[model samples]
Target: MRKNRLKLGLFIPPFHPLYENPTLCIERDLQITQFADEIGMSEIWFGEHHSGGYEIIMSPELMVAAAAERTKSIKLGTGVITLPYHNPLMTANRLCQLDHQTRGRLLFGGGPGLLTADAHMLGLDARESRDKLDEGISVISRLLAGEWVTEKTSWYDLNDAHCHLLPYNGPGSLPIGVASAFSPSGGTLAAKYDTAMLCLAATSPDGYDALAGNWKIACDTAEKYGRTMNPAVLRCATDMHIAETRDEAMDQARKGFEVTQRYFANQTAHVANEGMDVTLEDLIERGEAVVGTPDDAVAQIRRLEEKVPDFGTLLLLDKNWATFENKKRSLEMMMRYVLPEINGDNVSRQKSFDWQGEHAEEYFKTFQQAAQRAFEKHAAQTEADK
Candidate 1:
């Protein structure tokens, strides 16, 4: 077999395990992330949320900075940062500062703010989200590019604006990833800007199929604009729980997904009429969440690979706010017992390390997603029997 070279990362969400003590939350998060760095993991990516339904960490930059200082190798990312919530100038400057602070170990993740709570907390309405995201990104992209630009609209205004943001190792370098649950618009932007696409995989291959459509449209859009698109830059996230036995795995996931379902249910109350059909737990049992022992999870993942061969990037971990110990145990199990088996890639580590490798972020989040990419590539290589 050819070398798989797949990457795996622990998805560190802000939501605490459902049973964690509030006082020890910060300490626990630090401990887990540091351990992930020490455990020879590729990256540690977290998302942004306001009003604190689960975890207290909301500022992706602040968290990335703190993670950068503590760990020498593991890549830190916004996992995602909602672009629409802040003044473009300030958000762009801050992200650029983080890039410099981490010496270029930063990923620019573009996502519109989700819940009404997050928008409300920012003193905005969700109805204006798409427009806000586009405007903010327009300004941020130029600001990072050494462009003296201006944007004047009824919504936001910038006059003769310029920003001094240092690019990583080179004069112009920073890998940006765009997060989209199901919007073709994000996929279009990803290709247009040469950024990667992130899809939440906590649901099903059905969700994978849905996101894949966006990726396709993105490429089509790029082609329409006389631009080239590379299918290799795909990214996705999976809600996965691994354990010693199938029953044990299901039990762990039951608790975690229950909490997640409730949290989102409460958050999506006013928006319930949006026709959100499936519960988070339903996404779990339907081969989407991958809740089971290693063998079972592997089978489910392989099926997904057969179906969507170009998918890459995935979030395999979730918040450990309430059940810190349980979550930690699960993470350890995943690292030791589950991950190596699925991708079965060669992993090298030191009690401490000198290099974290170049594609650390991709390697971490794109392991299973890579399977789809691989299956697609592999099948293409083999000639069909006439």
Candidate 2:
């Protein structure tokens, strides 16, 4: 078992139904960040999406800036800024600024954008996204290192471009992460840039199967670069919703799951065509989601640990499967019960309790002997007074 406690966090691609108010949806997201910070969650990430009505945040940097003020300790991340859609120089500058704004609490997450619709809106070929992301990270990494970058590409050209401000902790001090779904591209890029690997689909059957293979890819790629992949920075994300009981959790998440899945099915071809008919049982049986009690959540995480063995964090992929209150309750339950169990946080306490139980007779005998001694001393004292 990895002795180091696995950190807990949230990756809020933030699925909201079309019927909800957008303003309130964003506010709730910020509130969740604040609540997570108060409850000592390690971090929270916001996503960038332009075309997806369900995953609406548009600018994760803007969310980070807003969340930075509202939060104190939890690290804020661009769950990913779609690298193919933006100028590397501009993105680097914004990242540097956010690093300072968050007082070094910003995690820069970059990815080839997820949605083809988003790429289409920018008049970009979706096929070129991965290459563009690779190029973008390279340029951004160089610029952030305080190097004068004079690079040219079909999409962008930098003429002696340098960030006005380096990362708050100095160049290369800012933590970087790349999103990996089921492909080796993310692992390859992570090793190339020495960034953390964010296994965004770790709980899905395919993603789970790829865990060891992806780590191997990262390690092999890093060997080429003479750099070692750090398992301590590897983060795995999964869908989870927990309550006091499995039935209660299932009830809370059932309707929301339908809404979100239907949206995914419409926007994402890879999503199950069953749409609204997809049941919570279907997700659980497939190991695609954990919509049950905290014990169920612990089991899901342990299952992941079995595959990867050593990962830095378990990030709950935030969903609106439950109401805001229920969602908050789920997070609370995770911190209060699920995390402690997985990390063995209460092992010593349990041992101490069992030891006391085992020695109950001996302890009672000692107490009785002390009481007898006190009574004898009092009787003698009374006689002396008389």
Candidate 3:
């Protein structure tokens, strides 16, 4: 109902199959979260995958916990957890407990399993995925609203089982969300439950225009019930990377991003059995990509705002999966430079790369010598021979 403008979120891609060495990845994600908090970035969300290259793991709850532990002020979400795949009691309990744990710092996001492989992994028929989604969601919704839900179905049943756990967030609704990718069913379900909707997309405004149109269709279908459902919390993923120089940032981003994109495009290809061609320029023009220099990119984001008046959040795919160094650089650029400008929070002149890094290190070296002299004297005086 709170129609705040331009919320920022991040999508973490599965960088490795081994899932080894998440300490660095965790730190990097937290760093972005911390910075977003500092800069008043509105919200943050990660996603879920069972197997495949999306690497964050099969659990958005765990990743949400990780981010929650590191941040106090930002709204953390699952972007969406595939609801149909999990037991409703466990799933509802997790969302309730996490909401309690973070003092309601959680956003409950859900979706039917996107991947057929995901349904297969759980030994469920792919045909039943969406049906299970409805059933799973119904159980959670009832329990959260303090209904003594009898989970009576092929999937589940709970006689006299309900949440006395937490007070209802509102008279009629739980803090529920749904993820949809051009599926009319996803949108309609969100509306049916009065849950917020999180829509996922790869970059390419051309496709994005098409995609948002799909959401509108879902929204229109939801409108048949009327009487004013909430204003609708809708989100789109933006693949993001920002830096001092346009050319350098794009060059660094290209190889790493394309590799990550291929992983996703391939997953989508197999699941939907449909191939998609995603482009950088289309991403930029669509206003959902993580490319471009700070200046131009901010303008593009604003352009997206104009194009999609209902846009709620810009989810950034800021991960540079190739290396810690690249990932850290991407984070720094987004936080220190890109986020502020795009949020309209700062307008300082960013003549960053126009001046130089290599060309300017020498100048900083002279200042470093002066700083060292001043620091040594200050330390000697302050420590007093210790």
RMSD of each: 15.0, 1.4, 9.9
Q: Per-residue lDDT for 1-386 in model 2, tens only? A: 46577999999997888999999999999999999999999999999988878888999999999999998899999999999989999999999999999999999999998889998888889999999989998888888888899989999988989987999999978888998999899999999999999999998888999988999999999999999987878999999999888889988989888888877778545564666666779889999999888888988988988877768899999988899899999999999998888888899999999999999999999999999999999999999999
In model 3, the runs with Cα more than 4 Å from the true position are: 1-3, 17-27, 167-174, 202-207, 229-232, 265-290, 318-386
List the candidates' TM-scores in order. Answer: 0.78, 0.97, 0.75
The deviation in Å at residue 68 for candidate 3 is 2.4
lDDT of 1 at 363: 74
Query: Relative to the unseen true structure, what is the C-alpha lDDT of residue 146 in candidate 2, on a scale of 0 to 100?
Result: 85
Off by over 4 Å in 2: none
Which parts of model 1 have CA positions greater than 4 angstroms off? 1-4, 17-20, 201-206, 269-282, 321-326, 336-386
Give lDDT: candidate 1, residue 76. Answer: 80
RMSD of 3: 9.9
Best by lDDT: 2
TM-score, cand. 3 vs. native: 0.75
If the candidates were sorted by their lDDT against the true structure, best first, what order would they fall in?
Answer: 2, 1, 3
| lDDT string, candidate 3, 1-386, tens digits | 12454566666543542345656666666666676666666677766777664565567788777777778788877767777677787787778777766667788787776677777878888787777777877778887776776657877767877765753354234467777665577677877777776656534534456555656665676788673333336666656666667676677677665666666677765324423466555555546565656676566566555545646666775455335555556655656665566554543334555556646878889889999999999988989966
